[model samples]
Target: MSTLDTSALVIGVDFGTDSCRSLIVDTITGEQVASAVEFYPRWKAGMYCDPDRNVFRQHPQDYIDAFTLAVRNALAGVSDEVRANVRAMSIDTTGSTSVAVDRAGTPLALTEPFRDNPNAMFVLWKDHTAVREADEINTLARNWGGVDFTRYVGGVYSAEWFWANMLHVLRVDPAVRASVYSWVEHCDWMPALLTGTTAPDVMKRSRCAAGHKAMWHESFDGLPGEAFLVRLDPLLAGMRERLYRDTYTADTAAGTLTPQWADTLGLTTDVVVGVGAFDAHMGAVGAGIRPYSLVKVMGTSTCDILMAPAAEVDGRIVKGICGQVEGSVISGMTGMEAGQSAFGDVYAWFRQLLAWPLALLGDTPDAQSQRDGILHRILPELERQAALESPVDTGMVAIDWLNGRRTPFADQTLRGALFGLTLGSDAPKIYRALIEATAFGARAIVERFREEGIRIDEVIAVGGVAKKSPLNMQIVANVFGLDIRVAKSDQAVALGAAMFAAVAAGLHDSVESAQRHMGSGFETTYTPDPEATAIYDRLYRQYREYGALIERLSAAEAHPAPHSTELCTPN
Candidate 1:
């Protein structure tokens, strides 16, 4: 493989929830030269999601299609020299999203008989259908006499994670279970797919995904013991060896781009593919992470990443957060992750909720067009009107758990709650309350870290929600009672992936050096307003109480008791 020297170019592919984006950057200057994005056609058509059941899947074909389209389009306008100068590429994807694969590493959905089966597709990160299975795993882990499997990850694991999804599928689909050889995380599989190393034994796994979601760690001597998997499900018997044991950080090369992929993308075969990582972790890198600097990737969901010196972390497990792993974000640093399951998703839900009525009541073609128009304007209008109101203006309060809680606990069974609604409440009033609820959820994560002895000295916001929503930016700042700096790059996640690509290709000796050269400076800073801060503090307390009540109600329904008062016990 050819190593990139000075003036070399690299590509960073960011696979998001809805689309894939390719970014070409100058290795030396970190300047983005060209970029392109293409939505997942099948996903856009709602082919793999059953929203009613909280089942979300993405076909690997959607990813393959987007891969070719995004990269080809991105390089379309660039000069031949620029395309040829591309020394390496790296990718970041949503996680703990994972997919079932055959012995050859092909996703089952890509083959016949399983071609249209959602169970055979890539399970998206937000899929919560495995809640019961996750609960079982947690119960077992807590009671096990052996080392806690959740030591590296937060104390609690979630249905949104890897093993839960895999076990859930195995139990539900005998055909899939019989055909599948092993499972691979999206972040790990994508790069391996590009490098033609999808074989279960040869495919490289990601430290970020494996450490955070699959409970793979050095202390455990790799994955959870084979006995643990068998205990969880007899169907998992002998599957541990099919999956990988070793994991690499994003700075390492998975392999050179395969000849087929190189030819398809009009790049040379020598282009290296860096080991992959989840989008938020790389986004944190793109946002320029420092010790105690919290990077919030505020997209459909929010992944809050923080890294600190390894000595400071002292191998202390920060309970109730996501995984805290070494080299997951930056090599030689301790990476900590926390996130809400839904952020922008909450807004999208509200939009869908309102649009249902417009679509049902107004059936004409003009009416359908009008409904689309209304949906487009609703959020922006709400933001404008809500910005004028104070926290007290609306007697409404919302809990940002529509997609369930991801941090402080990984309970998918809990649902969202909205209380204190009155006839006086209008669209904007309720909307503002929802926005505040999200900010409050974010604040809870920050506080959880502090409570666990992890300091967050600064907050950096990135992704679509951070750049587009002034109200959200200000509210989060006020809620945290700290200034929030928005990263300058709108494509920080992709840019961060590119930074990794540069390092893997030897253009930079390390990720820190690449970050120093390519780091996009801050674009805007949101300073907390004193008046807003006081009001939010009061409401935040109420939000927690309200959320607690909902949790109690959910638990009571799940396990009925004559006079149940044990629910929502103090943590």
Candidate 2:
């Protein structure tokens, strides 16, 4: 360990769905010094995406460009003292956002031949184009006469994960497959890139991403066996050897920054870069997560993280979560993940649906400005108006599967549905229904943990929706019948990364120690309203009943019985 520098600052860069943000914080006080954000130009322009097909890809140059500008801009607002004294940095990214790479660990999208190819770019975590591959993986895991790799990942593999996305790309694009040497998660790649250790064999992979999304468990001796891969697909025959066998937690240092990166980010080569992890895992740490507490990272989607003592959860596998990986959150605790695939996204979709008229008033500058103003105000206005509506009087129930369900079962094929809507149902009423639907979805996750014997003593909320929407938070609290605390830091995910950086740089002995010295406490607590809770409880039962019916109908439609004239006949 190195000497502690109480004055030292650390940088935490969070690569999110739409943009990248950099936060600089004091190592000892945890005071946020400066911050900057840069939206990915390409992504913001809606390049390389087809929402109808659930295909989303981001160019690696977008990450490189965005983070570089964000960090430099963040540093520009601070003194040279802050810049020179920065001792370390760490990163968190949307997980299962991976891309094919060459032997040198250069993303294929960065190479000249594949520079413009969407297939060679980084697959965003929310992309669900790999549903078929995920189903195949799940089926093989269950029936294969060997180790069940997905057993630790809640007995289900999701289309949003590493293997499914990789397999999907390989099967669809021969050019990417031919040039690819291995695949690397976005979280793993950033640190490796900064530390100048981008070689496929040398880069340190994230235990959080690998364990949760890629099924890399110590008991499995790393990834699943070569036999399993070969059985799953001939294309994956030798992939196990190409991919990693070992993983490191975020508390460890990946390496020191290289001179080029140091110059690029206005830092010195002495600054250490810690191993990266998924945004939600690190966000939990930033939110002051403790054992038996659930931290919800609410943004475009919601990723719920809960850490427990390893000994208590040793042989227990919670059936339908993202995964349970040891040391993924706290250094010595077991981290379990669960989430709704759509939370804020559902609201965004509804807003878009309402704003369709804006598309017609286009091209003119005045029209454009008016359109932008309306778009900006739509959500806030909806939240306010919806808050005024009576929850029980709406008599509308909605299923929050607009982007598919992510927890209590990882099913992506299911679509969002609304019921009991009449002509009298207005925008505010429908919007209120959507909010309740998301809340109900969250309650389902909390109930799943309880059913599995995992005790959740408290709930913490962090992210855009949590901070901006009191109505959403209150509804969630009522739905769960539990109080919810909002984390104080607006940049909790980035702050969590800084905590890891502090430990990796030896400014702190462990993550817990760093957190105690630097944590931003809760800003507000939302308590369940008794009357609202009672109404929500009744609506929640209906939500579950409706969700089950939707799931059954979806499954039956996907794989109907051979001679099924049953649909034509009444029961």
Candidate 3:
């Protein structure tokens, strides 16, 4: 019913940690035609999370509601003919975040009494409530004679990942656990739901999600053996059987859009739906990731993506990273992921901490307006003031672990610390230290890859921090001692998904071809300052020593003995 032409469009849906965005892009020139974003209402209201406990969840209805709104709004002004010619749709979502589903493929939170329960909802990517479960996995995997499941995932299992979250939920909520038929990642579910393949046992799983977060690797043949899972927990005995063994790449089509969804979004049912992936992985493709090129998606959190030729990597397992998977970013290359648990989040936390005094004087309307104005100007003003002081002027250093360490080893038990605070240290002085801390966290990830023989020739940055925060960008450039190129597209993650959609719809032969024509390219480069780089190099050593000291103290506190050598002895 629709004609294929240069004017055809493909849509990319990016379901982020806080919002869902729908982007319509022209197939010919990769120009963005229209886009709309809608934040999760309940999530924005903070209805389902206890930040103090590190518990974060989002109701399934919020995702459904936001997606429908975003798509409809994005397509509002387009002509009917233009809508009919849309070739395909693709999706990307925050990783490791999953929801428990019923036999009918309905998320538990969408049905019955569970509708009001937070545990029945989607666990967010940053949720670290399963720290104990993750520790158990690491210990058991190390002792088990089977293939090391943690090897591909940086020799460490994380509370922020799949199995730990599943195991923890099963232990905590017996009602939901009994009702849940299986689990599905947010990335995989969006595409499956669009194509009407929401079957618990048969929905398409993503190689990106499975390989990076669920310990799925070619070496294990599929997921870890049932015997190994049973050893971990009897409840997990049959989960592996329920989950699909075959995972597809983003270039593959999930299926055609269902008529029900098609009508709602004013699209033709013929539009194909491509397989889904994590946001950062798709973002790397959007940023034009080539072999040895590192792409960092910097936002509330940071997800660092790098790809290399499979032959060049030599199958070496990089320690202390998120994971390394073949075809995760590009079809023929090995994609490696690493990240900081908090980046912009550190600045946000500081703002909240500073708001206490303002909160006490907020009853009057004038006071409220003043509070609002302060929030608006805080970050930019901090950057302005902070520029006046040198890194050594403050003699202060901070750790960006308020949300825990996500890479170079995943440890949720760690908390942030700041040293050298003095009466002379003002708000801007402390803010500078926080920014520097996040930069250091990123540097650790890059260094880890190189230490493991993975080359990084160029660095590309995409996302809010990269685009809007000049201070952060320059600091990152200096910290890594490398030139940082910021992507031109503000919506690179969504654009990357659109590229996959183009391939799935046959507009392009592969993702690479689509990228060649559709990529937004780099807009600006921030080269490291020789003077600043040298100063950061010295501060980095101190940061490492401080991190080690904190770990020692935490270990001693956790296991107090008359004399403990755990900190002193090497693992």
Candidate 4:
């Protein structure tokens, strides 16, 4: 590693599903000097969402407000000199969280008439309300006698992506369709917003978000052509023109911060804003990702990122995973993505299920306190008990498709299932099964990569679940029959953004150099237990069998065989 610049500082802001986190880091040592988090006020209040319908929307103002507060608060903990030395900033966000915008790139939700309209707000990445639209896209891409836009994206278009969500909104809302000028991903928009270059054509789009979600590949000559989009839906007729033709890697600087934003954030106008990308991509970099090393961002949902030299991937496509985009992670490497749609979220769902009685306990202060206490303890206690359960003896098996499958094929229509449950089944037993199921889901992704000739030499884990949950980590390691290393930084996602900022600010020659100087080493490693791995190998076979059966059943239910009255009598 080269000598680092101790005087330089960079800020990395991470926008998650519920909150934004800001971290100030020293460019020389990668020490997290100060950090703060602020929840989106409107999202925290559960506004513009319908859980049952799988429709989730976030107002743009919430992002702006939360980011502002988080940065200001994080900066408050540091000295005047440290704050003044801030050279550049970068951001990562959950995607394909996107919103409709006017020509100037202002989100529709910020306008007067669309202030409260969910359709005008950002459609969150987990929102699956656009299933029909996604299906339409898949069907069109496969049969439309044009370029298969989804070929690089696992040959499936997902509801939890950009075009499907945009199409869904355009088809349902006439006012929005007529007035909207373009759409913007949350990751791309923030840097543009800070730089005051919000115009759809002028803003630098993220290669990661565009390639993974919107099917924007260099071979396509930009986004899917107007004819293909129009054939999918008339509402998308002119959208191709409205969007941009080029996308940028995160190492590039979008622009310097505008005076207005600089004043708002208590920073200088010279501060550079690096182009943003999806959280998991940057998080992988932050965790010290290397070629063929899978970095799993284990969070509410998971986004597993892998990188390889261009020569290794070279025109070969891996089916049933997320998109394989060149330079999405490192400038010259192939960044491949795959993930489980629900990881930690599955645990949270069970916790909520177990705490149902708390709803009836009333909203008084004491009752609320009791409810909070119990809720907080539920997961830890479950983890403890689940750890004690015999992994081989637990007959229960679960499908971690509660939020649908995101990898080994992206199918948002699939629902979760539990098998082998009996009268003797208890909460801890069930919880153990759920944890095993998630691990199995992860293993399936790893298997797919290997099956497709992509080598995974090691696994590095980052994010909340990786840092907090040893039980889950051990299960995952056992299921994979491989050792798993957890990254030391708690805010690896933000750290990644800062690394990119360092490059964009000219503090480092390349991402690799910045990482060499700034990267935090692994905190611990989880080695697979031989006995547990042997047992899981058997259970994994059973899990696959059950999953295949469930998928067949689901397909039959969706498209049943027609009845033949005459045939029944003959039989």
Candidate 5:
């Protein structure tokens, strides 16, 4: 019905930890024509989490609601002709983020205590409750330096990743675990739902998720080995076998949408679904990363880095570094991922504590409208005022492991800490300290990567933090002593997913070709200032010391019987 040839549109959906977004992008120019974002309020504003401290898990239905809402809104703004021309739909979501489903393919965790229950829901990518099992994996893999899969990950694994949650489920709920008939990544399953398929043959599983999270391979039969999984947990032995399936790259056509899904969505069911992937990795592709280029997904939490390299580091994995198979990001080259444990979540925590009445600030709001009167708005203004107040006024620094370190060390039990606090400390000082801490966390990961011969040439920053906070971006540049590549598009993840769809539909021959042809926008780079860098270097040492002290305290709490006060660093 539509006659546009080069201007064909594609719907790319991003399934985030708290919400889902849909975007309509011009296939040839890669320009986003229209967009819609839907937030799960129960999932948002931190409402549905456990009373105790752990990350939030989402119901797959939440993503479904978001998918339908975002799709309708995206179409609502387009002309009927434009809608009809859309050739395909693709999706990206947080990696290894999954759910248990009944025979009918409905998410079982959505309705009950499972949403807040530690064991019942999808163990989110940032969740840390499974650290004990993760540590064992680390210990078991120590002899090999890390798993062969570590090549895709950064020669290190964390409890927050897919394997950690899978093992955790097996250990804690052994009985209920067997009742779990199926386990599918939210991004992988989303398209299957649209097309009516199962894990085995229904839709293509992303090589990014399959390689990075599920331990699938470009070269192997499937998974690492049943023996290794049995060592981690006996149940994981069976779990790995069940989840093992043929993996597909980002550009592969997963399946066509089913007639039922087409009727419900009010578009042709022939829409293509590319194999889905982790939001951040796809964010890199959407940003048009060249070989060995790094894309950092910045948000409440940060998935710091992913890249495609030119050559295989022959001894890279052998040097006790973590790596995954070749062509993890794209088909021709390998992709690697790493990140800071906390970013926006730290700021959200501070806002909750500081956003009180004027009496709370001990200063009156003079003549200001209530619209600009709240601490939420006032805090940014104060941070600006204080940054200019004195170079040392934003003097406090902290380590951002508030939710524990997701990488470099991979310790989840390690908590947050604020150093250099004084009687003069207030909301602004503490907030800036938190910002500096996350910047340092990024630097640590960057430093570690470069230390092991992995070159991170450009830091591509995307997500809520990078888009909204200039101060945070400035600090990040200063801390890393490197310029950052910022996405011109706000919805990098959604755009990335759509790029996959374009590849799947044969609009482009491969993801790499699609990235060049259809990926949107130029990058904005922030170079680090030398003066700021010098000051941060000294402050970073103290920040490390402060983090080490707290980690010792946490270690003591966990193993109180024979622990000393010495700080422990990773091997």
Candidate 6:
């Protein structure tokens, strides 16, 4: 094989829930060196709180393991000569995936009440333990018009956001609150660790992570005034020291990799580590997406889109958007992101519970033969089932908040609902409902963006979900009422991180230039159907009424019955 001589060699490590993947990047050419993926063996036991519920988490050590394997594998592909030219190293990780570290920066062996507790361990982004807190934050933020600080966070907050989860811990588990000196996430903290910097050395933060997850703002005194904290939890007033000033984009070097970490990852100590950030943002860049252009990181959960603009929208924008921050995506633009927290998980759960061959199920199923994933042989039984249905004849409409809404209305307390279910309903009815729910969710976000005047000129889709399932895209097109561009790169997040490594190593002058040359292209596009759009418009109105009624009733009742839709419900 002919080899390409690159000016700079850098590594971009992407830490996912299952494992960490390292990509070796040629800064000059914007090419991927031999990349490596490491999976977590312990994932089976700890990762799933319930297959039906979209519950998940990952150990920090698993992250380190992923990084180690990815780096070593990349180096194995490098020639002895190119190895010497290697410069900076960096990592992109899932945000708000946090752990309690001691003064020495070690995560204590998880204690009782929290070991299995999703909140205490590493509350994965999809984790919903703080649903109650999220609801409260939403109420308060909406009450205040976000004047205090939440204005940056789309007028409302969710339990998944940094502040809500942090406050949830302090109120729920006082002991954990006390022992935890530093509440840090691997996305940001891992870079700090690699650089041999702790709170003192590098209390520094990633602008992307802080702006999106931690609510860090360079403009107004970094993450709302302390008054908001005191209002949430009087104890939180002291946490100002832990929060850091938002650093530049992830391409900027946070510091040099420390000797110990370098040795552990089998890399040279000279490697540069950039401030860590969420995988979704990097995926946008990796897919070669531009700001004002939205990129979807669709995997187990569908993180909807990210964009940046020069000026902020007037007044407030949407209800539950994560954030609109300067330099969050690329420098000098407001990076905006929102997500559908349960798409993939919902599909996965359907398959696991119903395992039937598609041919056997046909359009109709007897009551005796109803099962979830076990009944279907397709990768996603939901998609397969939905694809077989007539354009839109299934008498099922669902609220796609099974794992709760991630954008538009970031309420974790919200649950999934299936309306118009009758005895005639089958697995396909429920399956189609799930698809429509996600489509409606997307519409909610798109509408929110337009309302804010973000001017979502174009949309580029990436991720395993976008490639594997065409029906999902069609549903999304019909649902959101917009055509979306699918990313050609299957591994867009890893590619995005590599792009950053190139920039930090001086291979690329800026991200936009890198995106032009190195960015992956796209395939087919799915345009919205106006007929389906009109039908969906009527359905969405019903979905809104049903959701508002449920929310009001749930608020009134001490323990209202569960929502109509059931994921793992037996056939």
Relative to the true structure, how large is the alpha-carbon lDDT of every model? 0.91, 0.93, 0.90, 0.93, 0.72, 0.70
lDDT of 1 by residue, 26-133 (tens): 877778999999999999999979999999999999999998999999999799988889998999999988989999999999999899999999999999999998
The window of 10 residues in a row where model 2 has the poorest summed lDDT is: 562-571
Query: Of the pair 1 and 5, which is ahead by lDDT?
Result: 1
| Clashes per candidate, residues 3 or more apart or on different chains | 0, 0, 0, 0, 14, 20
Alpha carbon RMSD to native, model 2: 1.6
Clash pairs, candidate 3, are none
Error of 1 at 484 (Å): 0.3
lDDT digits (tens) for residues 1-571 of candidate 2? 3446767999999999999999999987889999999999999999999999999999999999999999999999998877899999999999889999999999999999999899899999999999999999999999998999999999999999999999999999999989999999999999999999999899999999999999999999999999999899999988889889889999999999999999888889999999999999999999999999999999999999999999999999999999999999987899999999999899999999999999999789999999999999999998888988988789899999999989988999998999999999999999999999999999999999999999999999999999999999999999999999999999999999999999998889989888887799999999999998999989999999999888878867876778766642112
Top-TM-score structure, candidate number:
2
Badly placed stretches (over 4 Å) of model 6 are 1-5, 47-57, 109-120, 136-147, 312-318, 355-376, 380-382, 529-531, 558-571
lDDT by residue for model 3 over 86-184, one digit each (tens)? 889999999899988888788899998798888899999999999999999999999988778999999999999999999999999999888988999
Provide the lDDT at 345 for model 2: 95
Instruction: Summing lDDT over every window of 10 consecutive residues in candidate 1, give the lowest-scoring window.
Output: 562-571
- Tens digit of lDDT per residue, candidate 4, span 1-571? 4435779999999999889999999998888899999999999999999999998999999999999999999999988999999999999999999999998999999999999999999999999999999999999999999899998898888889999999999989999998899999999899999999999989999999999999988889978988998889887887888898999999999999999998998999999999999999999999999999999999999999999998879879999988999989999999999998899999999999999999899999999999999999999999999899987667888999999899989888888989998998999999999999999999999999999999999999999999999999999999999999999999999999999999998999899998988899899999999999999999999889888877876777676667832222111
Best candidate, lDDT-wise? 2
lDDT of 1 at 502: 92
List model 6 lDDT by residue over 187-210, tens digit each: 777777788775632556678767
**Which portions of model 4 miss their true places by more than 4 Å?**
1-4, 564-571
Tens digits of lDDT, candidate 5, 1-571? 1223485789889888778899999877777899999997657656546626575676565677778888998899989889888999888888667666544554556546454554556667777777777777766765644355444455466777677777777667754475565567777778777877764434566677776666566445666667777776677656655565577777777778888778777789778877777787788787777765667788878875445453665446422222444655677676766666678888877775665454444434552444245745765775675465333676677778877786675677888877667888876677777778888888877777777777766778888788877788888899888888788888888888888888788777677667766666655678889998998898888888887778777766766654555544432
RMSD (Å) per prediction: 2.1, 1.6, 2.2, 2.2, 4.3, 6.5
For each candidate, give its TM-score against the true structure: 0.97, 0.98, 0.97, 0.98, 0.89, 0.86
Alpha-carbon shift of residue 445 in model 2 (angstroms)? 0.5
Winner of 4 and 5 under TM-score: 4
TM-score of 6: 0.86
Q: After superposition, how far is residue 47 of candidate 2 from its true place, in Å?
A: 0.3
